[model samples]
Target: MKTVVIGFLGSILDSGGGPGRWEKWRPSVSICQHDDLVIDRFEMLHSRGHIRLAEQLRTDIASVSPETKVNLHVCDPANPWDFQEVYGCLHEFARQYPFDLERERYLIHITTGTHVAQICMFLLTEARYFPAVLLQTSPPRKQGSGDAGAYSLIDLDLSRYNQIGARFAREKQESTEFLKSGIKTRNAAFNQMIARIERVAVRSKAPLMLNGPTGAGKSTLARRIYELKKSRHQIQGEFVEVNCATLRGDAALSTLFGHVKGAFTGALSDRAGLLRKAHGGVVFLDEIGELGIDEQTMLLKAIEEKRFSPMGSDKEVESDFQLIAGTNRDLRLAVAEGKFRDDLLARINLWVFELPALRDRREDVEPNIDYELDRFARDNDVTVRFNAEARKEYQRFATSPAAVWSGNFRELSASIMRMATLAEGGRITTDVVEDEIERLQSTWRPKPSQSNLESLLPAKALAEIDLFDRLQLDVVIEMCRSCATMAEAGRKLFAASRTRRRAVNDSDRLKKYLARFNLDWAALKH
Candidate 1:
């Protein structure tokens, strides 16, 4: 379903530079061909030789799927070109390489020379040409703190690239070219939400709880708050996030409060917890309701006393992080059932603000869609215009009761992106919208017969899948219940399972089976 390429710049020793540290750790890369591209960072190009390594990577791709097409791009520093010229060469190579040039080709920089060259690659691919095809490589582990590990590959779109560019611009006094180029700024309810938070910034020191589904701009809002405060005050801190579901037992406290060396099994060194790092900035704890009773107590103590002892340490380290908690769960229910601590809830709920889902803001749909379509067009260097029918189709789908949008903004943005990529004649059509909608749904909805598979799997597997996969899949299925033809379902199912190790051996086989089952990869993963 995706076109792929393996781009090999000459070894860093030869090419002068490749991806390095900061680029490797960020979450921005999750926006692009997350499933299809694998970033492989190496200190030096493999001794296997360029042709051999390329062939081997090709073999690896083929072994994953016979239909998987991997193209090789070799960048040589000896060719003697600056960043712009290197980018030009990349464009030229992409133009010449017909297969997988658009979607499947991955840029693998095999250089270790300097970080300058790697920064150039990131700027070209992520900041400028956001070809869905390029996947950058990560660096090897560091022997020391100063070693810039290989850069992480990112599939960046305009929004995420802008986020990074904005960060750099603010930090280094850089140009605005990267920040304001594509994104359309608007003052919506979201802006109002930010305004309200700012108004309370100094007046209220209570923990602000931002209640919303993930990607409903909660993280962005949190960052905006930190930036605004940092600009005005001398607050030296970092914005940190903790996914409550992943914070288990002692790990939760240790993550929130740093642990001394020998704190636990993996404690190689004394480290700072999120709370400590956040310091005067903000600690955004997503899925806050998932916190267990004991963790809740620890959180209350830290919030109330600004003091916490790291695991296995007698001395208490002082922390002063402003807490911005978020969750999609019903904490009231959790507290009523005694699953949540009443005192903890009392502390967190002191300044609660519920963020409405995208669907709940139907009036904002068309504007948001228009903004996204424009962004998608600019990033890909292609113009996509929505015809009347296409506009109506998208609007209708947005307002449709059938569109559950359980994942809220994240799902909607992803669907819009896919539609833009698959658009024809620069005009989005009802057909394209339908296809995307069906593709999104097919992941979760099982075929009429495979619904019987419910009778087969063990209860734990069923339960393991319930919240993560099943419910979300059902949401997509319910959106496309009116589909007259099964073509859309076929594409969704194929796209969903293609990356999975357990996927059927052949694309055709999986496609056929998905058509038989009316399901997609999202369903299986969920």
Candidate 2:
């Protein structure tokens, strides 16, 4: 197999006085002198002006290593420092050069070019333009020491370095685990979501919107993202959290964008609000869809410009922060209703992650139970664990279809805390588990109006519908009952279809579907 070394002819470094040139360590010549690194061929690139120098270096290389063949190629960029021209020239050369990977190995010599040229070589090699490794040669430490200098090979292929690739995989796993709060969650979808969130949390400073049902850990995940960024030194400030649902009217504006003295009748002094307080850090706006339109406008400005005018103050205060917005309500529906600014939604919708409800991820319930118990132990200094039979019994009930888990992780955490508190010694026995199950069942029990479809439809009309149609209608009716408007309910029901056919009116489509059953949105709500 042949070893080929491709490099630029360094006009200055490769030049030397006659006869005394052999004493001086020249990279182009010294490289061939290495007995171990047998170079079968040297492809030296040179400018038109360096023809003489190129020939001289070629001869010197041949004299030192008679078995080596030296070939000179003309590749001159108008401006050597220009990255585009240099990269393009080299890229063209690489494209034209015949690379025989099976029979020969190639080394890109990076010691003899402009910084831009060196960088271009590295990029091309890394990109597999030249199926080669990078060879960096350095001059000898002492002058006139007759040293041949040193050469090191840098393999651009990461797979060749098993330890490095394994390290990266390990770090990614650790990051995903960190985002999950170290719980070994078995749900594949949730694990995949966390992995993507981990990547986005570390790599992006854009606003991240977490959409999930209430108590589905949106707030908890947002805080964990902040902690991860802080741990990686990606964030230098504090994590300021605000539940937007708790803010209203003047208080909402004053609480988020700050207010000066005498901003309102009750304003007595200047106050730096949550946005300003989150400068150089992260601000989590939980239940962001609850913010009024006016508050949304100001919040949008603060996010984009990193500055906003405080109440009763013309001057704008600056606060550079990363925004993580959480909401249970569908913001798109709110936008259609003129409740949320579309532009604001567009700005914060760059990275949207929807956390699934607990009922959707039953497989994760067992692991999360252990996590909750561990948390309880840390908080109260009392360790607790369920016995084998009790653990099985509790897990069975927790993962059962009957366990709605309306409050998601919050409900699960509370259940574990309750059982742990009532456990005998350190064991949560079947008796305690059964009591907890009954308590959960009672809390999850539905009211007559919500539980019974017969309450909404006459017995004769309900009996006429097929079971499948009845089941679907029940779900749609439930959605309508929960939503504030027909449009909102339609949006929830046809969310996926609306994405595919944007022109289709969701409310109209839903209305037509309801009419098939001799029903309307208004009647379903009643």
Candidate 3:
């Protein structure tokens, strides 16, 4: 197989001068001298300063080995010692470098470049950006020795070494733990989900869409991803975050894409906007489904082209950023209803991950309770311990099917904080847990007057239907009670869906839906 050697040129003048010069040895020259190593091509990478030295070394190598080919490549790194710049230069170089991995072997000569350059080469090789093995050259044993130095091939495919492979596996586990924020999650699904997110966070720059109920930790998880990526050196800029639900009209456009002076009524100064602020970093758009169509259109263009014009400005600005969007709404349904843009939804739906709500992950309640308690202790600087009875009571109620944590973690955090605040002598007693549980239950349940209508229907009829169908019925009943006429309730209930129909029959559809439950509008009105 043909072998290609890629390396930088060190100062050839440093190789002690000797008569007939076969006595002196250079790493690039010595590596070629090895009897067992056969190289068809040597790619010598040199800076502008090292051109003469590189040429002299090339002549010396060619004189000794007439058949071997020497190809000189110029690489100028802005800073040889700067890891990021060197890595970027090499990374770009590798991206464009032509490789025939199937027919030939490639070797990276790590002995000649700066340590930073060497490390970058190693990383690129490890990441398979540069599909090559490392070749390290050693100096001769003695000054007067007739022998040239040694050359050893470093194969980074860890699977060849069992112990190194084990270490790599352990490191992956540690990385996954860090991404998880050190929460010892119990659910298999949640653990697998976290692992998947870890992989996506490290490898992908495309927009990540997180969809879940309110307070399901979407915002917290997005921030965690930003921290994880930053720690991994994948991102360098600051994490720019904003909730789209709070942005409206001109404010949304101005806040996201910035605004030129005199753009709007109160546009007094030019703003850099969140996109520009997030350049070389991550931008998290929370409750993205709440964004208006105009905002979505601008976001779509910005995400694809990395360029957008500010409000009332013809000038386009650029910001290279990674995107992570979080929303509680079903974007697919939103797109179908014309409430969200189809193209924008399609783009973000590439890496969609749905976080289960607290109610869905009942098994995790015990761990989350411990997590919240520990967090409360750390935040308040006061050590608070839950009594055995109190802890058990809290877990029992939290995991119960009746426990509807409507606000999810937001509600749970407040509950723990409240309990910690009320705890006497640094101990949360069973009574404290019971009081919080009752308070949460009261908050979760609908008002007695509003929900009295659920009792109006026969219990047997509701019991005959499944929970899902029962919920749909409950919503319809609530709307009927609130609206003055059946037609008005129908219009509000299916407003978006009705727009797609050639002929609208809202009141009839509502009557038919109610009829399936053995109830009529006339009976309900009476």
Most accurate candidate by TM-score? 2
**Candidate 1, 1-526: lDDT as tens digits:** 3433333423422221134522332211211223544433211222234555445444433543454444444555443346666556555654554453444444434233235455555565665453542444443365323333344544656575787778855643221111212233343665455446656754565788877656666676666656655765745688888889898887887887778899889988998888888887778888888888877887888999998788889998888888888876556646765878888888888877767666666666666687777778779888887779877877887777767666676777788888888877777788897787787667545577654336434556566664645655554454333221133334444566656646444434533444444554333322
User: lDDT of model 1 at residue 350?
Assistant: 80
Global lDDT scores for all candidate models:
0.59, 0.89, 0.83
Candidate 2 vs candidate 3: which has greater TM-score?
2
Candidate 1: where are CA atoms >4 Å away? Answer: 1-195, 374-383, 424-430, 441-526
User: Which predicted model would earn the best lDDT?
Assistant: 2
Misplaced by over 4 Å in model 3 are: 1-19, 26-135, 140-147, 150-157, 452-472, 475-526
At residue 487, give the lDDT of candidate 3.
65
lDDT minimum window of 10 residues, candidate 2:
444-453
- Per-residue alpha-carbon lDDT of model 2 for 390-448, expressed as tens digits? 99999999999889787889999999999999998989999999999999899877675
Better of 2 and 3 by lDDT: 2
Model 3 TM-score?
0.67
State the displacement of the C-alpha of residue 276, model 3, in Å, after optimal TM-score superposition. 1.5
lDDT for model 1, please.
0.59
Per-model TM against the reference: 0.49, 0.83, 0.67
